[model samples]
Target chain A: MNTTVHEYRTGWKRALIETKISLTTPGDLMGFVMPTAIAIVVLLFMQGAEFEGAPVSLGAMNMPSLIGMNIVFGGITAMVGALAMDRTTGTLLRAKSMPGGMTGYLVGHLVSTAMFIAVTVIALLAVGLPLFDGLEFGTPDRWLMFLAVLVTGIVAALPIGAVLGALLDNPRNMGLVVFPIMGLVAVSGIFYPITALPGWLQAVGQVFPVYWMGLGMRHALLPDAAAAVEVGGSWRTATMFAVLALWAVASMALAPRLLRRMSRRESGSAVAARRADMQRDW
Target chain B: MGHPRPHDGPAIAVADLRMRYGDKDVLTGLDLEIEPGGVTALLGPNGAGKTTTIEILEGFRGRSGGRVSVLGVDPAHGDERWRARLGVVLQEWRDNGKWKVRDIVAHFAEYYKPYTDPWNADDLLDLVGLTAQGGQRVRTLSGGQRRRLDVALGIIGRPALLFLDEPTTGFDPHARREFHELIHRLTDLDGTTILLTTHDLDEAEKLAERILILAGGRIIADGSPDQLARAASTTAEVKWIQDGRLQIHATEDATDFVRKLLATDDGAVTDLEVHRASLEDAYLELVAQFEAGEAAAAVDTFQEATR
Candidate 1:
């Protein structure tokens, strides 16, 4: 097999094309913009509320938290949904038909998703830096730290999404993933500090990547003294990266086996049958 | 990049292919072979294992026991290099609905670039007669247009062999005719071999140089459409009024039978009718007899009629 770099280049090109189309399309543009718009509106509303005797307004704190949440939370749900939808629509089978198409598809999806997350986060920052008090990014260290957290958070989320996608055969059952994440968000403390929750709720939040992602973002962009209100009374940056790293490693290990199993079962007739079932479900 | 494809063997070769799902056998020791570069249609009623057989050939499904090869490599072990030499078009395709027609062609064209010289997107669109809809999103295309696009995508890589599974199942006559013309045009593309499966006997007769009728998990009939249609039965039944009484007889030649009947009746015969057994009637009757029981008898019946 004389597989070449051209296949990956093609995949990257697919991502670029797909991203451009989504940005231009009305329905897809809403998905990209609506969440960030809502986040900005919420930040404007909470600009005055102080959080647990911290110098930062609740809105300033919530900005980084929302960005973090979007990475880990939105990444998983969106990937799971995209995979299930693609299976029913025969896109997966179409990919399998080509020589290096599967690799191109996956590389395209991951890069495009990262591009979308970056765009949403940038939109949040564009509004956050000027409108909110107590948010910091002037120094080189802060910028590097923010970029690191964002990259680590994305690495932690993409494989988990791929695994969930392989497990859930029906997109309708996406509520299985959504409902649990909704419950997790309440405890992960996107709108406030996790230290304010019950000790047990704080521990539950810490167990998943969602809470750690929030903490990493806070460590990156929030004032260092703001960590006084956190669970350990400081930015536990090492533990946060360590935990997210473990999540990434574990999921990356499992994702390939499951995704391979899923791809093996894909065929033209199989896709047609699954699509027929999906229509009946509708 | 300079590797030359080996093209000396039959395009497809299969031996004793078997597929078993739990206790049920879908394919029982089936065998087949096709020399490269001609259209062959696989005709079978439902549940005759046509899908199973085709899927196995496409390397999309595994078989219980068999040796199968396409393009000189065993399909079970066919690699990307092997895959690049074949094309597949299925029954339905609504994927990539968000992409423009030309963009989809362009994107997939990229996938084949590392392996071979694929068709240019515009030229392929023109070949499939979809140049007018190149700018439109795929979801807006009508059903026939969509199938044409599927064909365009399938053969974009300039594959040596193309598998078309029931290409015109729900097509209206005009649409089917245009699709058939497009299929005919495809034959000029440097010895591209096509294997299509359908239940439409007329379509099989129209498009295929050879037809294989798969029934009872094996191909019982294989020949040109003319031969298969002629094999079913060769006699016509004649009915007439003779001396105010109805007379009926069966003969191989309807004209000769009618001539004899009228002459023997001495100018009293009237209201004559000749009912030759139709190709469709033979096919449907064969299916009906197979459904009635005695799997062995179905083939026996056709053979006896032919004899």
Candidate 2:
């Protein structure tokens, strides 16, 4: 890599570590940790449910898909919130002017988001496996299924989060955008299977990526159980990954352009004009 | 005024520097050279392009037209090496308010190439009289304290050239005096060249060896404070008590008249006071003249356009 890229990546890693440790307030701590915990608790609680082809219990339900939705709410939503604040406060502009600026900034945000999600998922899993008596993963295939789902879900969620962050300049607006998507992911098959929803609602949920992502996860985590349901098909995993890969690639490509445009709007005179008005009012 | 001292080189030089916004000109064919290791005060009111000029020099804004050089490099293309030599304290700022004072300073230090050690950051806090509160969160500090921290951070890297934009806008009289001493010490002890922009005339008079007055996006006057005072109106006010009554004389030859009065045993010449001119007075007079000239030019342009 070039010197700029290397330096930015290094800076980004440091920024991430700093952000994770800087959490002080009770509200902030909960904001990061609660969603992951809730997802795990709800997943384990709904273990013995009836599906179209089989009577599923905690021992046979998909664990990886539940974890994916947890990452979406806890990791991606938090990333958007933090970046929106950075943009509003002029910290991002300062980062642009400094050496290895944008590379470092984006890297820092991504690393922090990933780290938090990993920690939250692990913590929830540790508590979940013991509390949910019926849930078990003794086989190697089940473990491989969980890994594939985890990797695919995180990759899919990241670009959507970045796109939301880049477009919404205000944290309030970002919250408005995030909560609805998060709600859709949560209520869809991410926690409980979409088959539980009303017909029209299930149709609506199917249009979203979360439904496909959850379906893909079920195939990986509980392949035999998933096979019994008509929803499991060769096309489901292939199609979900294809569409998600497109989103991830497109969003990553578009993020820098969006960020550059925003930075240009935040050029020196723009800041000066704002300060001049503040001075006048003062 | 001190004699122009011999210099190793000009610290800053701008040749035919031009910057435009849309069709309007912010800086028009501007040219300037500042000597190394002294405070050069840029004096101008709002909308005079003072901020624009400083931002361009600091490498924050790109120039539309001109060859501008600062610390021997064009700011537009200056690399990390050049940035290492520059310390800029802009009017706008963003501190993670949650971070402690010392933490903020330490973080900025990492961005510089060859900054002073940890002690220098501590010493700066003491220098700015914020040593006791070094551990306090920045959000807890007052506006003046935060501004002082801004200065301390600006100088922490021991930059060869420092740009301060209205550094003492909200400082009280005592704090302003102390900040002036801090700025003086930066040059005297470290040989750091400083270019400061300010609306406060008293600050410019107290801090700068050379002051440049800008009006309507162009420099109207440039000289030492005393020279600007003299170059303003040549008229002087001659006041004296004559026959127990106050008498005032406005004349160009006030000195000669005062000498003549002294030559005689004129007890009536009691309370003799001759007021020549001052920097504030000179600045006001120059602004008035510039406005009149602009008004006349506008009328001529309007008539020509009509024809």
Candidate 3:
């Protein structure tokens, strides 16, 4: 096999091993489970309430939005967190030492991140489907649309995560990303409809992937009449796909260049310096 | 598993190498050459630019100005094929903490498969004396064990040239000894040139065939262990008891002095002892002089004395 091809094959193996480790390790497993459990609890509480002027329960309305929000969280935060931690710990330098090792390291993370997002989405839906009513999972079209939204959502968010991961020097500064993401979540209407928010806030939310991703999920799982609460009283499936595809294209263009620059700056001294900083902080 | 190189020049050659970290010169016109198949130690005090020099040669860092060739390729533009022929053991590695020793080794070994046959993970583990700990998490390993694992990864590709940066900084005596033995084993392999940096003079004496003492941005001393000791103008101290009186004398020739004293004493000399200057003593003096801002005088003095 060609060298790059072989490296990518090894990357897939790395992904498999990492996924197995994450699934088997208690702490890692809990990271996936805890959020799902909390979301399910929230859904149960909202099951009794109904959205104003909408036919579905509030729980049904929030379920798909939560799934969309989880996709963005899993794709973006997981990528950024993994890259920053690996760079801090000298894993990036280790990869730089070997032939074609950087390729393997990156491909491995992409695979693992995709798997993580998929597993989280599946787990959330599996637990939420039986406990909630008015969820539109009974038909093949719903499942297919759900799969499309899931894949497209990850593709849109992951490269941006990679760019953020590459730009940040200190893992401790990861909190810098969290606040903005939470703000985006609040404006993007993960818990409620953006239609009820200020017009400018709705416009601002529309400009980001988080809102569009939530909109895509809502289109897939919510009943057709539920579109009454969305902008223009329509699903706007074409607009959602176009905006997400644009984000994916723009991020994919920028991520590799930024990632390459970051990898070039990796060395043993850089790692040692970061380690020293971490020690001082602690 | 050795791959024939396209060229047969020295394993490493550097000339007029310079490294400046924002106007402060860490290495000023540093030069070195290493032949194949033996261990060479770059001995220096901390902040002597040892790590900078090694990292430049490893292609991990770009230099300010220099000419450096490792395995007949300039590291700045070295391709993956060029990289596959070299092994680098970093000073400290805290990566893959969640990985098992065997698994991590196996994963690294896979990267070398396209270039050459790599050491079997199990065999490499045994070679590094980590066979019993292969199943354990890497973060749980002791410091010494982790260093040994680092060595295992460095040699997994059967690299023609290996670079170790301070291989045993925090090792206890027994672990240091074992690490030294492992290095010796690596040198026994066919045509593997090893360059290691350390601040420990005793380690340099024990493991290296040639020693280069780097100080103040240059190599102040270069020779074998005994030659380095002799190159420094450090005399041995001779102690003896003659006619119920203690006598102590410092002399350049302890053997001749002891012989003459014994001949004159006529069985009266007692409690005679000779203490020659060890390599550690020579290193401490050279570093002290360099740090005291007499770097040029220290180098000239050593070179003059040795010549």
Candidate 4:
């Protein structure tokens, strides 16, 4: 086999090993389970509270939104966190020392991130299906749409996460990523309706991938009448896909250049310096 | 043992290499060369740019100026093929903490499959004396064990040249000796050109065929261990007790001075001792002089005095 192909194969193997390790590690496993647990508890608490002018209860409306928000969280935060931690730990330098190692390292992360999102999404649906009413997964089209939106959502968010990860020097500064994501979640209508927010806030939310991801999930899993609470009383499937695709293109275009720059700066001394800094912080 | 490849070119050659960090020059007009299959040690105090020079040769950092070639290719433009032929054991490695020793080593070996036949992970682990620790997590290994693993990873590709940057910094004496024995085994097994950097004079003497003393960003001294010791032993100190009084004298010729003292003392001299300047003393003096802001003068003086 060609060297590049072999390296990519090695990356896939790395992804498999890392995925297994993550699943077995209690802390990593809990990272996936805790959010789903919190979402479920939140969904239960909101049960029987009806939304104004919408046909479904608040719990039902939130089920799909929570799933949507989880995708963005899992895709973006996971990618960013992995890059920053690996860079600090000398994994990036180790990769650079080997032939075609960078390609393997990157492909491994991409695979693992995708798998993490898939597992999280499945877990949420399995738990949500038994507890929530008015969810529409009975048809093939709904399942297909849900799958498409989930995949596209991850694809759109990953490159943005990569860009952020490359730009940040310290993993301790993850609050910079977390705070904006929380704010985005609020404006993106993960818990309520975007129309309830100010017009400008709604416009701002629509400009990001978080809002489109949530809207896409609602269109896939919620009852048709649930569209009444949306901005224009329509699914806006075409617009949602267009916006998400555009974000994916823009981020993908920029991420490689930024990631290359970041990787190029990694050397043994850089890693050693980071280790010393971490010791001082501790 | 693998057969040594026929290559007439030097394993590493650098000319007028310069590195400036921000406004300060770390290395200025440094030059050195290492013959194939020869173990060379770069000895220097902290912040003497040893790490910078090694990193540039490993192609991990770009130099501000000058030419550097390792394995007959300029490091700045070295391709993956060039990278495959080189092994770098960095100063510190805390990566793969969650990975098992065997798994990490096996994973690394895969990268060399397309370039060259790599050592088997199991055999490599045993060679590094980590067979019992293969199942252990890397984070659980002691500092010495981790360094052994680092060496294993560095040589797994059967590299033509290996770079070990202060490989025994935190090792205990026992571990340090064992590590030295392992290096000797590697050199004997195959003619792998090894270039290591260290601040320890004894380690350089023990492991390297040639020692390059780098101070103030220049090669101030270069020779084998015996030659270095001889070059620095230009002065000797003699101590003796005569008529219940202690006497000490410094001289350029201890043998002649002792001969005259013994002849003139009429058998009164007792508790006599002669101490030749050790390499450690010379190394310390050279470093002290460089640190005292007379690096160029110190280099010139040492070279002139030694010659």
Lowest lDDT 10-residue stretch of candidate 1 chain A: A1-10
Per candidate, native contacts kept equal: 0.66, 0.19, 0.67, 0.72
- Please name the candidate that would achieve the greatest TM-score relative to the true structure: 4
Give the C-alpha miss distance for residue A37 in model 3, angstroms.
Answer: 1.4
For candidate 3, give the docking quality class from DockQ: medium
TM-score (chain A only) for the predictions, listed in order? 0.96, 0.79, 0.98, 0.98
Using TM-score as the yardstick, the better of models 2 and 3 is: 3
Model 4 agreement with the true structure over A51-139: per-residue lDDT tens digits: 89888888988899888888887788888898888878888888899888888888888888888788878988988987988888999
Candidate 4: stretches off by over 4 Å: B1-7, B239-249, B256-272, B288-307
Top candidate, metric DockQ: 3
Every candidate's lDDT: 0.85, 0.67, 0.87, 0.88
RMSD of 2: 6.4
Q: Candidate 2 lDDT, tens digit per residue, B1-307?
A: 1111223567789877777889988787778899788889998765567888988887777888888888878888877556656677766566366667877666655555332232356777887788888888887887677777877877766677889888887778877777788787777756789999997778888899888876656665688877766655466788988788898888777778888878894465788888875556655544454456663343233222222
lDDT of 3 at A12: 94
Q: Considering summed lDDT, which 10 consecutive residues are worst modelled in model 4 chain A?
A: A16-25
TM-score to native of every candidate shown? 0.94, 0.79, 0.94, 0.95
**Between which residue pairs do clashes occur in model 4?**
none
lDDT (tens digit, per residue) of candidate 4 on B153-234: 9998899999999999888899998999899988986868999999888899999999998877778789999998887887
TM-score of 2: 0.79
RMSD of each: 2.4, 6.4, 2.5, 2.4
Count of backbone clashes, every candidate in sequence: 0, 2, 0, 0
Q: Give the TM-score of candidate 3.
A: 0.94
Interface RMSD of 3: 1.6
DockQ preference between candidates 1 and 2, better one: 1
